[model samples]
Target: MSRIGKKAVPVPAGVTAEIAGQAVNVKGPKGALSFVVHDLVAVDQSAEGIAVKPRDETKLARSLWGMSRTMIANLVTGVSKGFERKLEINGVGYKAALNGKVLTLSLGYSHDVLFPVPEGIVIQVLGAKSDQIIVSGIDKQQVGQVAAEIREWRGPEPYKGKGVKYAEEKIFRKEGKKK
Candidate 1:
């Protein structure tokens, strides 16, 4: 049995759920998200909430059942409440700004790097210093992928600790060799 799959997914009052063949469509105040049900996993709408069941007790099937249900639930919630990721610029002179739909980053480079923000993703600069960037979107995967790509532009250096990083991410500094 899958613990996560057994959990009931609560449906908000304004949200509407529809089952179309193997696809499930969830419509909420934010938007509508549809997902295809897997063969090993079965989804059913109940008066209380949505329930997911696995066809077999095998390890792979059980895991997939739970993960698929969780992913579907996340999609519903994301379309309703949305998701956001924050990245901090650690080095001096490193900053970010939004020019229309383009994100301009200055990561101690000779030239400022300007990247166009993808559709459905919003970029915002926090504080007057502009050292903080907030990426918000309805899709969790897209938001994370965008953040990762931005971070890759100027990944944190082990020696100088320069570049973009998550707010809670820790950087390990190496000790200098004795002269």
Candidate 2:
């Protein structure tokens, strides 16, 4: 019995969740989202909220129990409040700008790196130096994937610690060479 799976996910106000077959559809003020649950886990809704349980005591079923529950929770939260990922660009000439649906980055490259923004995701460039980017979307997976792709362009280096990094991320700075 997984602790997280055993707990019921409460449906918030102004949000509706429907469990149909192996899929769960969630709709809220922000947007609508759906998730197809695996057969290993059983999902049902009660007056209190949604409940998830493993079909059997098998190892695979138990492993997916908590994960399925968490995925459902993410759908609910995402439809209601959405998700956001913030990235900070560090370097002398590193910066970012949003042009319509395109995100242009300057990471000491010879030419500006143009990143085409995908649908359902909004990219906003902020900060006084225009080095901060905020990626927001109703889907958690898409938001995270887009953020990761952007970070891959110019990952933070261990030496100077200059590159793209999460707002809450801490880069380990290595000591300089002793002459």
Candidate 3:
């Protein structure tokens, strides 16, 4: 038995769930989210919570059963509470700014790098430090993907530790060679 799949997902107040064909739709105060279940997985809704089950004991079905439950739970929670990620820029002269929907990043390049923000995702420049950035959205996957793309522009270097990184992430610094 899959522990995660067997667990019940609690339905918060004011949230409604509907099953239509192979799709499950959840609507809450914040927004609405929907997902389609695979053929080997089944979803059942009750007054207390929702349950996800696998049609067979095969390895693939077991894995999909657990993953489907978690994804559904995330969708329900995302539309209700949303998700956010914080990023910090390192190195001198490295900074970030938001102009409309574009993110202007100065990462020691001769010219500023402009990144267009995706729809439904909001980017905000926080604090006078000029290095802090906050990305927020109702979809968790999109928020994480955008953050990763921004970090890829200047991935942390082992020697100088110059790049964009998570606010609390730690990077190991290499020691300089003796002359």
Best by TM-score: 2
User: Distance from true position, residue 123, model 3, in Å?
Assistant: 1.0
lDDT of 3 by residue, 62-134 (tens): 9999898998898888878888999999899999999998999999889999999999899999878789999
Ranking by TM-score: 2, 3, 1
In the range 139-171, model 1's lDDT, one tens digit per residue, is 888899999999999988788788899877898
Model 1, total clashes: 0
Whole-model Cα lDDT of every candidate shown, in order:
0.86, 0.95, 0.89
Better of 1 and 2 by lDDT: 2
**What TM-score quantifies how close candidate 1 is to the native fold?**
0.92
lDDT by residue for model 2 over 1-179, one digit each (tens)? 68998899999999999999999999999899999999988999999899999999999999999999999999999988999999999999999998888999999989999999999999999999999999999999999999999999999998998999999999998998998
Model 1 lDDT at residue 142: 88
Q: What is the lDDT of candidate 2?
A: 0.95
Query: Candidate 1 vs candidate 3: which has greater lDDT?
Result: 3
Better of 2 and 3 by TM-score: 2
Off by over 4 Å in 2: none
